[model samples]
Target: MRRLGSALLAVGMLVGCGPGTQAETPPESAPSAEQQQQAPILTTTNVDVAIECSGILEFANTASYTLLDRYLPSNVVTNIVNRRATAPFTSLADLSSVPLVGPTRLKQLEGGARTMDFIDADCVGILDGIAISRDDQTAIVNLVNTIDDSELHDVLPDAWNGAVNLLNTRPFTTAQQIADTAGIGDVSFRNIRNSATLSRPLEALFTAINAIPSNGSYGATTLRHFDWWNIASANHYYRDQKECFGLEPTSVPYGASIRPNLANAAEVRAEVQRAFDYVGGNTKVSAAVRDAGFANLDALIQGRSFKGCILTYENDPWSRNTVHIYVDTVNGFSVMTETWWAE
Candidate 1:
């Protein structure tokens, strides 16, 4: 059950989240009536899930360089992997294209933990979202758990103060629900993207921690599915109060330094506007159709990037000739493509 002043319960100031969505930019998570009506079955475990998902690069493509360097056939690493730097392997499937990630090696990767759950989907351009299975709890928790309590003071004040209260509440299907509720800001999300983690099998990790529950606590239960906010939020993140997506100060340079390709966020936003404006002006598109496109863009741009960021792509099937945008502030960078024709 939720605490007395939990953000969700006390988000009395309702404000529109944009043009399309039902949730407002207040301290309330966006659970539908059905979700709210259903009583939550909370599970508490003294055991913590040891692993999240693979780190940024792994989600984008493969496991860490060290893992690949050690695991892949020595011949393959020398002939195919080492040269990838100059060529830049975009996806794990590209390994096949690179020539040495042959059938035997691919099979090895499939059975192994190092390269197992990489999200390598086809992308025509900038990816809009990253698809992660709920079973891949590691990645979901990794990104969400990165935002620290200290930062939340300004970034998500409501969440920081009411962390315990919020956890006493129900499940969240999407991080956006919590972010939208707390009215999270851009600075917080960006600061958060800089700190993330990963790499360990879910089953083994659970088995290890769950071997014994602590202090008469119930065993921990995690979500079956948790999508990256295409944005970020702490409320949607903390499955339990003790975990912060490992948000404490860290010294891991690789995860700490990763970021998206956009050189400037403002420039990217301007380009997004110009693309939509051009689509809205298309004579071939009916006035109603054109207006409809703008409306979709309005909701997407406003709400889509609220938690994370919106990625733009060229020749997207979503529009006739306009750009297709992907809103992902979830995994920091380089997971994989989750393409959608959603206008």
Candidate 2:
């Protein structure tokens, strides 16, 4: 039940819409009406980020051998786990005590730590408010205790009346109380648990938005607008196919036929801000939240992750160097920009 579910795909329209690290100015030609119709629908998946810690030290205390192996070799992972079993780690220095976790690997772990989540109840201080079902019962309890009635109902449409009543009671001491007080059946309770997955907070979304570099290497600039061709081309490619762009074969198997367009950094950032607001339930951007799967901004963001891919133009003009940004959203809201040429 803790595993990620299938990414729900809905065929929806592409609406158009970055910079920095800087790419060459792009030439533009609008897509034909028929081409516009053919543009790709934004793709969506249930956001399910894995648990991670803020730093290597925290990871040492919490990560199982399997998770540790992601950062260390099996031998190193075994040593770390065994060492921790005998004496818990109190700091990063302790990791070096484990065989094979040399200074180089330790530094790599330090860098990788930023990408991980810290869900250990004993370790998580501020992050305790965020919850996923896989975390201890306390996380589930916190979720049921804190979620908005409207959001609860949205996640469990079948239990609307119960959801409102569940919210009114306030501060349920245990996760089980949710079902008991609301009269929501086992099915609804399971729905609540399943929906409890959320890895980050609302603020993290802004952090990611701000993190889109002003200039990326490989002629990658902040994306300004995604033309109809980019939209249609991107739609034809799935995450892996697009990700494979920089590797070779000159063209994507997904059938993307044109080079990407890059433009003004400020304009692209502004558009991304608008997209974030629209997705976050800020009605100023749109009357409705674009995706029904998410009850609110928090719902969309909790388990979400953003991925970027590099497209190189080494062999063909059609294969212009570009960066593609993907978010787990109903509209795909995907956009691209030219990047520096890749070798």
Candidate 3:
């Protein structure tokens, strides 16, 4: 099982981050002692993410739908929305009194106050990697994958320990199952069910790239030396093939060490040089890789990914906004920035 079983409330959790994007920033405060105890201990369900029931407006992505159906079902989501037709929900409790939401669901609602695991209803990306759509709704933006436990601490410090502890002990299949068995507040479950997926928000993105019918026209990038999109596509197939089976996702480790045969060498070279810009100074990136024991650019990226070669800066230096890197690892040349699942 994945170490972050708790990180994914759904699917193999988040996958395949885009290049050039930054990692989630670390927080100013550690989670309060209280929050550390209540966070949801979750696992990927490889389930389809339900649509957004933003409560602010009828979702537009689906021409015929208007609410999320992953948690319970469409009829139920519709009922809750219909009841609150006049206003947006301020909290999950708005539905606590609804018929289907009995004491158990209510408990989930109450828990929202202490801990949350889903994307905010206001968030703009697809949720939990399910790819389900809410009618008329666009996907959320800047959504971070919550599947990485180390990253989770900054965003939800309160639940970080719970997520970690749970991940260490068990592997779960559904958010509802985790909530019921793990006692994650019912509301937290609702948050995950209601929120956008944390999985790599790039399926549509990569698909669009592959569909470009690139017999050669679509794969080029300005960076000049490499095929960024091609690498991303290769990375996708390597990771998604397993996710297609619904098994726990095995993370693609940073390469055993940078070596000449690495697939994403071009992009890795570009980013390693770029790392010097943010961190500052002519020798920053050089020093970074050199300190790690490599000197020249080719040697620096020989068997590794940008993950090890670049210095992690305060502003989510982990993100590669324009390029994705693949390393020679278990997932077999998978990128580390985002999450992906076989839909």
Candidate 4:
């Protein structure tokens, strides 16, 4: 009876352990959509490893300079480091041409060592626009917003007043009326008017006057009427003319104590005719002629120089016909009259 009972129990246990008797299959681990989408494809350590390995592979080419340094032998962990000991790398190209670093190694190095944290730290902001080449040193920094003419007057009111005052005091016979109409101030206008006969250009005289700040050191009087008018006018009018005529206008010699002798009206007229004749014949005088004219005028003045010549000529645009006046000191003439009629 006992043996028969043992046999039945063993059979029962084996029957319970059959294939279908295990717990219902763990519901098939099916990853959720979000988990699959957000999983990190690569780790930071993996990236670092890749870059280091690639750098080692491309050591012969890209890192020739670093390889030649003292740290290379001690730092290199590879057993094949002795192979590079005889690297006859005189130049970067020679190092790159080594057969050990082939295309496959080059590609690996390019991809892995494209960016390294240690190397990148040194390169931060290296490629900014502020770092210009030496040749581009004079490049102008363009202003985003430019000042308007109207705003300029408001910004520099004193300069405007100085300019107006200077203009008002100029010594033309019609200056007072012009000044009055132009709405120049009394005190400022009077000062300029009194000083106008000093024979300097109005602008230069003003510049000299204005150079004395409201509270500043005074200097010796240097600007004169001739300095103001003839010299100054020549400077102003001939600026554009100099470029057109290919002549260089020089600065006025203030230290020279020379006065221009006034040429008679007849001689002045003849000179004017000569200029007109040259212009009329050539249609345009060469730069050489213009330069010669300056020299001739200087010689004619004998230290004293006038601004312009005064003479009447035929009225035609094509024909150079107008009155030229020598207003500056070299010529006795003090007036320049020009008349133009629109056809």
Candidate 5:
């Protein structure tokens, strides 16, 4: 809610003053006689100054994606794109007749389209905590609340009322009111309030920040840490683990295993062979073949047994990546580390 100031004055001139209108006229002696003698007397007319309130001003971030998904279903969107590529619609009616589209839906879609074409089209200005149109200088602030009902009743509908409420009733102004109505105290209300008073667009900036990963090594992981390559790598490991050993992380207890103890070297070698074969045979191993190799290099030094082995690959090098494959005497197979390089 940035604030701007405006002044409106309606200037008019009083014509002839009759007997009954004498009281309304300024005293002749108050100013110059010449001024009073003027046929049209100057008078100030008070006009109610209204400020236009727009929903666009209220949006902490644009709702372009939301509007797109709502109005343009997948099929409709695909059809529209295809139509645009092949041939343009001759009329609005032809465009509206697309499948999964009705009059109401079409109107919403058109509004969104217009908003996209002219960035400021959807913006409505608010004056005195209410939405007002500049053309008629009429306040539609209260009408904003009825937007939902209007949609159902086939009237002029506003989809931005929720956005308006979010702006006007932001936590800064309405926190105390909300707490009071909800039978809570000011301290509690203040604790949960998310109203930001930053002069810039903090919310949109934060959204961008949240999308990137905090890890410096990886380019950028998602909030879910399911980056494209990570997902592909995980799927590869998951498929091999399931098919070769008939085992899954969820099915096996942490301290238990399919086999009671480590089998003989020959049996371990067979399992290692199976793992290598599985990885090698899979043509869709995302990285280079050299990057996908796995090996078991366990050996005994002195009397101590070296049970775990490192699976190294050229692309996923020791400097940047490490994959630790362990064979527990008690728990059989365990993947200790599967990490990627910083590049």
Candidate 6:
């Protein structure tokens, strides 16, 4: 993903007495003893960026104003300074402490830290090894759908060139789709998959505390049952990628951009029990759980799987107490938290 190349051209002006083009420095200005003794410890063609978790933490805690200003927006740098004043950042997840720092900004910060070194030793960060985040999915989908000849060659190595021209057809759904289209051999298939994965966008993950309903009863229920990662992803955040406890929510700038916080899922059995309790405890909830062959909340939690339910409250104005459950494979167990608030 990182490539380095540079070119230097020098032209020497000859003096009146010189037949060959050779420029010599005047003896007096040639070198000073002190200046000659000074040696640079590092040399680099480009800035060294830190992509690892610890490296990012170091940058957040120690980066100077000049360095921060070079990469982050002025307002964001101010927010970072203000937050750091309260406490030094503890983890990559603590990035949520700085407002306007999300997927995009995180990428900039990761590759922004500079050092006088030719190679970056801290570029070991990856989004996720086993599971792909939403950002990863979007980037991969885009790349496969729109790779040009040069881009295709650049992404895949020489061994994969055989399968390169075969990808001219548009819109590939998965690695398997490309393999099928090209009728590539096993090696080509493996190469394509590896390239696709390596080509996914690399960004630092911050623990994004998902917004819950203002009603405390509903909020507690949502957290206790549903997977936090699932909820954060539903809110369009990349979380649960790291192990960090007690993360704080970022402060949104007043009169700035504000997006709606919405989460929805299907076949939520145990996840909906507590919410159902707050809504006068629906019988369908129990029936769904029972029908799923789970005796109680403990059983459902221990060995939870997909289960559906449809609840409609006619008397209530908000949501009209309507909860519709369809078959969703995105997450096995999830709860829908829909909150409506005014400015």
lDDT for each candidate structure = 0.30, 0.40, 0.30, 0.28, 0.28, 0.36
Order the numbered candidates by lDDT, best leading.
2, 6, 1, 3, 5, 4
Model 1 / residue 260 / CA error / Å:
46
Clash numbers, per candidate: 24, 28, 55, 21, 8, 1
Q: Write the per-residue lDDT of candidate 5 for residues 295-320, one digit (tens) a residue.
A: 21222111221133333333433234
lDDT of each residue in 1-343, candidate 4, tens digit only: 0000111112122222222333222112453442132211111110111111222233322233232222233223122233334332222223235545433433333332223211111111111111111111111111001222322222223446544433444433333232343434433332222222212232232233324322222121211122122332242221112111111134222222222444444554455434334323233344455444434433333444344333223333333323344433311213222332223
Candidate 2 lDDT by residue in tens digits, 213-282: 4333232233322232243234422232334322124323364333343223343344444545433324
Worst 10 residues of 5 by lDDT: 191-200
lDDT of 6 at 80: 72
Q: Ten consecutive residues with minimal summed lDDT in candidate 3?
A: 1-10
233-294: candidate 1 lDDT, tens digit per residue? 21222121111121223411112222334223343345444433332324333456445433
For all the candidates, what are their Cα RMSDs to the real structure?
Answer: 28.7, 24.9, 21.3, 34.9, 28.0, 22.0
Point out the worst 10-residue segment of candidate 2 by lDDT: 10-19
* TM-score of candidate 2 against the unseen true structure: 0.26
- Write the residue-wise lDDT of candidate 3 on 87-195 in tens digits: 4333233444555754444333223311222223222222222222222122111111223333222223345444455445445443323344342343333333323
Residue 38 in model 6: lDDT: 23
lDDT of 6: 0.36
Model 6 residue runs over 4 Å out of place are 1-51, 91-93, 114-343
Weakest lDDT window of 10 consecutive positions for candidate 4: 1-10
Query: Model 4 segments beyond 4 Å from truth?
Result: 1-260, 281-325, 328-343
**Which wins on TM-score, candidate 1 or candidate 2?**
2
